[model samples]
Target: MTRKDNSVARLYRLAQSARSGQWNLEHDIDWSRRPRLPFWMRRAQARKALSQLYHGEMATSDLCEALLADATEDRYEVRSCLGLQLQDERRHAAAYQRYLEALGGIDPLDDGLQRALTAARHGPFGNLGAMLAYHVVIEGELLRLHGVLAQFVPCPLLRDINRLVGHDEARHVAFGKIYLPEAVQALSDDERRALYAWLEGLWQDAADSALNRRRANLAIATFFRRWLGGGWTRHAKALDSLGLPSATGREQAA
Candidate 1:
C-alpha cells in the first residue's frame, strides 16, 4: 500500500486543531437563549430539526466508535484524528440534546436518519466503508445543512452551536478528502465498484429521509435544493477522483 508520509503532519495538525477548538457544552453554549422560529420554519419543524440533529451527532459518534474499534496501530495519525472526532461528536450530541431540552425536550429521531444509521451499521464496507459513508457522504451533507441553518435560523444558541459543530464536521470531511483517495487507490477495480455500490445504497436511504423532504416555504426549499445539489456534485467529484463507478443513474434516480 502507498502511504503519504506527509499526511502524518496534516493529521496531527487536525488533531491539535480539534483539541484547541473544544468547548464545554454546558458553559460555552448560551442555554438561556431561545429559538426565534421564522414563519417559514414552524415550531414543530424546528423541534424536528433539532431532534434529527441530535440523533445525527450521536450516530457519528457511533461511526467513530466503529472506526476506532477496528483501527490498527500502524495508522496512528488517522486514528488520532478520528479519536478527536469522536470527542467532537459526543460534545455536539450533548449540545443538541441540551438545546432540545430548552425547547421542550427532544423529539423522536427522524425515520430517515434512523434508516440511514441502520444501513450504515449493517453495510458491507467494513472500516473503509464506514469512513466513506459517514465521513465523506453524511458529513458533507450535514456541513451544508449546518451552514444553512446558521444563516437562516434566528436563534442565538442554535447559530452558535451550528458554528462550533460545523467547524468540527468540516475537519472530519477534510480527513476523508485527504485520506480516501490514497486509501482507495490500493483497492482492486472490483473493490472500488463495490464501494460505489455501497455508497449508492447509503445515499439513497438518506436522501429519501423525511428530513430532506420536509415541507417549507418556497424560498427555503429552493435554498435547500441549491445547497444540497452543490454537496452532491462535490461528493460525486470525490468519487470520480477515486475511480469509483459513475453515480449518474443514482443521481437521476434521486
Candidate 2:
C-alpha cells in the first residue's frame, strides 16, 4: 500500500480507538445502589437541577459534529480532540443519568438548561472558535462554580457525582487549549476581530449566569447558605476566583 494510504489508515484507526474507549457509560459509573440524600433538602434539589443540565449532551454532540465537519483540512488534530470531547460529553450525560435515576428516577429538563443551550447556539460568535471558547473558557468557569457548589453540599454521594463531572470538564478544557489558539491563528484579521467580539459577549453571558441574582439568592438561602453566609460578598469572591466578573459589573462594562 502507498504511504498516504498508510497514514489515512493510521488516523482512522486512532479515531476508532478513541471513540471506542468512550462508548460504555454504564461501565464507567459505579451505580451499585441509590445514593443517600444530604441533610439540606435544598442542596439535594440543587444537585438534581445540575444533573438535568447534562441531559443536553445530545444537543452538544450534534453541535460538535457540525463544527467538526467544518474543520479545515489541516485541523485533523482539532477534529480528533473534538471527537474525544463528544465522547466525554456522552459519558457525562450517562453518569448524570445514573445520578438522576438514583434520585427517584427524575429526568431534569428545565428551562434553564434549554435557555443556556439556545443562547449558545445563537450567540454572536456562531463559528467553531466561538463554540470552542464557550466550551473551554465558559464551561471551565462553570466547572469551577460546580466545585464551589460541591463543597457546600453535605451529601457524599452528590459530591462524588460533582467530582466525576468535573473530571470530564477538565479534559474538555485541555482539548480547548489544544484547538482554540490554532483556530485563532487560522482566522483572517476580520475573523479574529469578530471572534474577539464574540468572546467578549460570551464572557458577559458567563458572568451573568455565574452571578445570577435569583439563582445565587436561592442557592444561598438553601444549599449554599453555609458557605455563603456573608451573602453576595462570598458569592462575589467565588466568582472572582473563577475569573468572572459580577453580573452587575459585566452589564456595566457592556
Candidate 3:
C-alpha cells in the first residue's frame, strides 16, 4: 500500500520492536513502592487512577485477544507481531490489576470506557477496524496522557507504573504508526466512511471517560484534545508519509 519499496519492511520493524523491546512487569517493578493508605489518608484519586488504568488495559487485552484469534499463518510477520502485542497487553493488564489489588480491589470500568470498548467490539471496527481504534486513537492518547501522568501523579508506584506502561505503549503505537497509513490507503470509499463514523463514536466516549475527575483535570484535557483532532495532525501526517491522503482530510473533503 505504501509507495516506497521498503514500506512493508518498515512495518516488519514493528514485529522487531515487539520481539526485542519491552520489559517484564513483575521483575521490573518494585512492588514495595505501593503506598500504604493510612486512616487519615484518603487515596481516592490514586485509587481511581490505578483502577481506571487497570480496567482500560483489560479491555485492550480483549482487543488483543480478538487480534490473536483472527490471526492466520499466511500473514506470519504481521500476525507474529500481533502475537507479541497480545502478550504485552496482557502483561500490562496484569501489572495494573496487581497495582489496584495492592490498593484495595477491582475498581470496575467507568460507563464511558465500557461504552467505547463495546462500540469498537460489536461493530464494523472488527479486526483491522478495531486495531485502528486501539492503536491509533486509544493508544495514541494513552501514550500522551501516561507521559503526563507519569510526571505528575502523586503515588511513586503509580507514577513509575505509568512511566513503564508508556514505554510499552510507545512500541504498540509504533505498530499503528506503520500499519494505519497503509491500511487507510487500502480502504474502499464505504470503508473509509465507516472508519470515520467509528472514530467519531470512539473519540466521544474517550472524552466522556476523562470527565468528573477533579485531580485529573490536566490529563482529562489532554485526552479530550487528542480525541477532538488536536493530536491528529500528527496522525494525518503518518498517512501522508505513505503518500496517501489523510483520513481526516478526506472526511473534510467529503
Candidate 4:
C-alpha cells in the first residue's frame, strides 16, 4: 500500500506531529480542589470506578511492552507511534492512581486481574493480537466507560481528568483503527485463529464484569454515542478490511 492508501503509514505520519501532550496531570488539572460528590457517588462509586481505570491503564502498559519487544526497531515510524502510545498509557496510569489518591484511595485491582496481566506477559500473545486486544478492544471500552462515568461523576476534578484523558483515548483508538488492519493482514492464518480464540474469551469476560452488571442499573447507556454507535461501527469496518472472518470484531464490552 502506498503512503496515502496505507492506514498504518498514515497513522505513523499523524503520530509524528501529534506527539504533543494535550494536558498535564500536574499543571493542567487543579489537584488542590477535591470534588464535591454526593454520598452515593462518593467512596463506593469512586473505588469501583478508579479501580477499573487503574487496572485498564496498567494492562495497556504491559501490552505496550510486549508490542515494543516484537515490533521492528528499524521501522521507527511504527515504533515511534507505539512509543508515544506508551507514554500516553503511562500517563493514564499515573492520572488514575492520582485520582484514586485524591478520593482517599480506591479499591485495588483484584487478584484475578493481576494474574491475568501476568499470564499475558508470559503467554504467547501474537503480534497484531496485542494491538487488537489493547488498543482496539480495551481502549474502546475505556472511552465508553469514561463517557458513561463522566455523565454521572459529580466531582469536578475527576470530570476534568476524564475529559483530558478522553481526548487521549480518542487518539489512541484512532491509531488502533488505522494500524490494526495492516498489521493483521500480515499475520499468518494460525495467528489469526489464535487471536480469534483470544477475542472470544475477552468478550465473555467483559459480559461478566462488574461494570456490565451495573450497566443495567445506570440510565445513561454510554456505549451508543461513540463506541457501539457510529465510531466503533467504523472501527469494525477497519478490522473487516482484512477479510479475516476468523477474528471478527465482537460487540461486547463492560
Per-candidate TM-scores read: 0.83, 0.64, 0.77, 0.75
Q: Write the per-residue lDDT of candidate 1 for residues 91-170, one digit (tens) a residue.
A: 99988887877778889986776777777777786677777777767766667667667766877778888888877887
Off by over 4 Å in 4: 1-5, 71-73, 111-125, 188-194, 209-254
Error of 4 at 99 (Å): 1.5
Worst 10 residues of 1 by lDDT: 245-254
True-vs-predicted CA distance for residue 159, candidate 2, Å: 4.4
Q: Rank order by TM-score, top first? A: 1, 3, 4, 2
Sort every candidate by lDDT, greatest first: 1, 3, 4, 2
lDDT of each: 0.75, 0.56, 0.67, 0.65
- On residues 5-109, what C-alpha lDDT tens digit does candidate 4 reach at each position? 576567666686557754677999888887666666647666766787888898887777767887464466677777787787888888888888766875877
* lDDT for each residue of candidate 3 in 124-178, tens digit (9 for 90 to 100): 7557667766666666655665665555555677676777777677777676666
Number of clashes in every candidate structure? Answer: 0, 0, 0, 0
Candidate 3 residue pairs in backbone clash: none
Best of the candidates, TM-score: 1
Measured with C-alpha atoms, the lDDT of residue 14 in candidate 2 is: 53
